[model samples]
Target: MVSTTFEDLNNSKKKLITDALLNEFSHHTLSTAQVSRIVKESGIARGAFYKYFDNLTDAYNYLYHFALQDIHQTITTDYHKKFQPDDYVDQVREFTEKSTNSRYFELVKMHLLFNEAHFSTPVSNHLIIENEFYWATQVLIHDAIKQLMLDPSSKELILQKLANVLHRLAKEDD
Candidate 1:
């Protein structure tokens, strides 16, 4: 997480650093990311980067949180509503397929790749999802997205299966 100092920065200055972080993380995996590049691109001093975050991973995780917030803002689901299966499926497709080409997509891919190695994981980040039905749906959608990444031809089939799976979940509660 970024320090309050970062939060205190002027909006334009903050955007400069955020843009630099985005460009670096979106282009390189965590293993290859360098703070030197971020500082250079943002035109901030090397010491300033450390003042904002603990390290590269800290900054990367902060940006990940920021991106997830952005994703949630665009989500169309009203989970408390009468469980419209179509709405759920569309949300899945948007979060998965449509986001594959997003600027933050590569950074997300890197997180997916290295998520397990973070020894001191937060509760939400842990794999022990207590919501069984929600977990099941997410797992199915995530698997579908993984397959879509390998083969775009699976989109139609994936969409059908996504709807079927969500519909099943919705029906189960009735």
Candidate 2:
């Protein structure tokens, strides 16, 4: 995601730095993520990372925003028009189907599979905070309701269950 943004960054060095940041952030949470690994993986000096971004958290935040922007453009703008909360189910099903075979879907699945426990921990501790996830999920459910693909009440129930499951996944101590 961030890679495309930095693809024509007009600065080759900066592009490499951004790619490395994105890779590391995707693989690890902010707490357990390491800057040295990114530096090594990016083939840049350790100091180069600091030069491009303020710190690991800053880089993560930036990449986070970048990924969300892409997700929004891909799902909302590409296939749908207005956001009708009632049509959420159809939207979710449609988008899910499309994304099911896409690299994006696979990436999301990988994140969910690997980071379940990490995310659940923060959620349990009231520390899991990211608008991207919330917005993405909301969009999914909202569309489902708007499309009448799923019962409104059922959609709400599933969303609630998702929140709890996410929390447990993140907080489960290994």
Best-performing candidate as measured by lDDT? 1
C-alpha lDDT of residue 51 in model 1: 98
Q: How does candidate 2 score on lDDT?
A: 0.52
Q: Put down candidate 1 lDDT per residue, 1-174, tens digits, no spaces.
A: 799999999999998999899889878777789999999999999999999999998998888788767766778644346657787777767776555766667666666665425634553354354466765765676677666655567777888988888889968867
After TM-score superposition, what is the CA distance of residue 65 in candidate 2 from its true location, in Å? 1.5
Which pairs of residues collide in model 1?
none
Give stretches of model 2 more than 4 Å off: 1-14, 77-83, 90-174
Candidate 1 lDDT (Cα, 0 to 1): 0.75
Give the per-residue lDDT digits (tens) of candidate 2, residues 11-63: 77666775676677656667778989999988877775666667766676666
Candidate 1 regions exceeding 4 Å error are 76-84, 97-101, 113-131, 149-153, 169-174
- Cα-based TM-score, every candidate: 0.77, 0.48
Local error of candidate 2 at residue 79 (angstroms): 18
